[model samples]
Target: MRIKYSIPIVFFVALVIIEKENNIISRVSDKLALKQTPQTPVQSSRSANTLPKRNVSVTSQGKLSSAFMLMKRRLEDYSDYQPAAAVTTRRKNILLLATTRTGSSFVGEFFNQQGDNMFYLFEPLWHVEKMLTLETGGTNATAAAKAYRDVLQKLFLCDFSLLESFIDPLPVDHVTASLFRRGSSSSLCGEAVCSPFVKGVFERYHCGNRRCGPLNLTMASETCLEKEHRAIKSVRVRQLEMLRPLAEDPRLDVKFIQLVRDPRAVLASRMVAFAAKYKNWKQWATDTDVPIDDDEVKKLKSNCNSIRMSAEMGLRRPEWLRGRYMLVRYEDVARFPMRKAAEMYKFTGIPFTPQVKAWILKSTQASKEAGGIYSTQKNSTEQVEKWRFKLPFKIAQVVQKVCGPTLKLFGYKFVTSEEMLTDKSISLIEDIL
Candidate 1:
């Protein structure tokens, strides 16, 4: 005799919607439980254009912001890490960590375009909810470690095939084909079609699976693993503590490549990009209590703060983060992209072939190698000193006043309003903005 099982359709649908909204659904097996469930992508097309609106309520915003910051701090506990075994051989692993708007997108594109075997997905981890919840209730180091471990286990051990099944309704057939093609089990898939989830799954697998050795991803059957199946074992690989324990795992070979840029330039671009969600600099300076209508200012502050925090917190985590990380300044990259790319390539232990170097140079010419290193567009050198003119005096002064010490700590010298336009400070300001 067989037992009969039935799940209420509406309840099932609700469960699916919750999972999708929370970005927790992974593993093809989950589809077994979620079959016949109705679902939609949490982020609609319109939502993509909208930044998570900053709450106008300072009390609530501050609380939430504080929470996420605390979570971020908790995560930092595992930054100081060393591989388990001593090695005579030297190798490189790369990870690029940057706050949004710090030129990470370009750096990712540059790597994907030019680096051999490197893949890029624009904002692959653009999980708005998770990012917004960077602050959560958690305790001290031991407690945080336990919580992180749990989260890591959940993420790493989850099944992803089910999550992909939920996405079946999406108009991503073309993307799927582009990613998976008709292939034998041994080949690596292309980047265009694979979601970041898929990429992460594979990376986690390659990192932890004892069957695979260092610098060897040439296994045939390994490449054919389905998306969800991969996620089941790789989902939580992102947690710092979990990653810390596995730092010595020989099965994983990974590296970090961080990118950065001038905060001023980043602020300028954000004003146009996020104008809808935040207030302008002038408006923001006047009132920190209310949410601004300008996306520009919101994005600028967020990006600047995130970058600063990443540099302060994330980059400095070599202790718990293992030796698999490297920071690449956007200015250094923008000025000498090829050289920096070469440096990055070396850091990642990915050999910089002439072909790769040429490709990097060709793609980066407009963004970095052109005559004026400080220009707005890399090809135009005259735009460097334009930010002082672009930003109102009061606003610029405020930004300088607010961010000056931090900026100077990171090697930026604040210019007085009077010196901003003069010949003496023009070149310095130009190089920065």
Candidate 2:
């Protein structure tokens, strides 16, 4: 009787061990989901390469390093820490390098959908890593590089074990109960996820904490690899400032997708967006801390010009860089997404799966309506030419004067004839910007 009871007890003990191991492995897998899978040794290797590097100065480096160290130290104190993993290893680091107001959001979505195994961080470091000028309080290059790397680790790594140890312990459901759940109108996590403050914290956690890991690292890696055995892809939407260094990284299989749009249309849409959110452009600029003369429309036009210049500069850099780059017009994406998407997939070396097609259709419809790239509903495609109708003639003339040179370079031809405005008033930037 003693021998029989011992055998039953042994079987129960084995089951408990198996369950514990499974739980740990699942957590490990979640962390790995942050990185792209490693490619074959032969395919991953690269030759020596160089491109135009950002002229980040020594002074800038010192400041950037200090900023990052501060952020990192604070990161060490956070409770829910997770580290990024190799699964977040993107096969090719893709930069949706474009100006604002181009259909980049949709393009980013398309790229995200293509790599079922790929991890995406939408405009992850734009706020902290935006290109700084000496005029903008001077920049520290080293600190900037470190900060950018921190963002990369946060986005790619899932090993947050160290960060986890730093948290100030609270009840298990404290965050959910006291903060997320109470104020939320609905039980859905979307409300909590969408909160600007909450979203900022989680995004920092998902990107920085090496231990916290991806949404489904284990499932994504095991399932995606077992099924396709393809390289992991990562898409990061970034403005011109951040693209300069990324364009030159040899270890990264970088591909740049540039989205160009009519500046007039962009100005009109931005003004409308600002007005809806604030009382006027001056108030909007003030609230956001954008450096510009309160009443000068040229400040806005100058900003627009700078944006175009940045895009053009990034798109042109690949000519010298070893990686691949492609230029895309937002209008084409809005009008003929499926046709263009096929080309884009071919360029990225990812197959345009059926699911990708469906996502494209949904995204295109949403972009058409919002007069912006990131929208959930279908709006109007006519917004491509909206500048003509929305901007007062005088304001439009000022924009034309300021951005005219840049616009012409981008293929926009201004309409000089007032009488032929309706028929011949084709945007000089219709083709490129």
Candidate topping TM-score: 2
Residue 71 in model 2: shift from native, Å?
40
> Taking the tens digit of each residue's C-alpha lDDT, what string does model 1 give over 1-433?
1223344666789998998865554334233322322212212222223223222111221122322232233323322343343332343323345554555544654444443233322221222223223545322334343443433222222222322222222214222222111121112334322223442223322322123221211222223232211111111122232345534546335554445555665565555556664344535545553243345444444345434443443433445444565445565566666766665655554555676566555555564555332222343233334454555445555455334423542444455555563443334321221
TM-score of 2: 0.52
TM-score of each: 0.49, 0.52
What overall lDDT goes with each candidate model? 0.39, 0.44
Point out the worst 10-residue segment of candidate 1 by lDDT.
228-237
TM-score of 1: 0.49
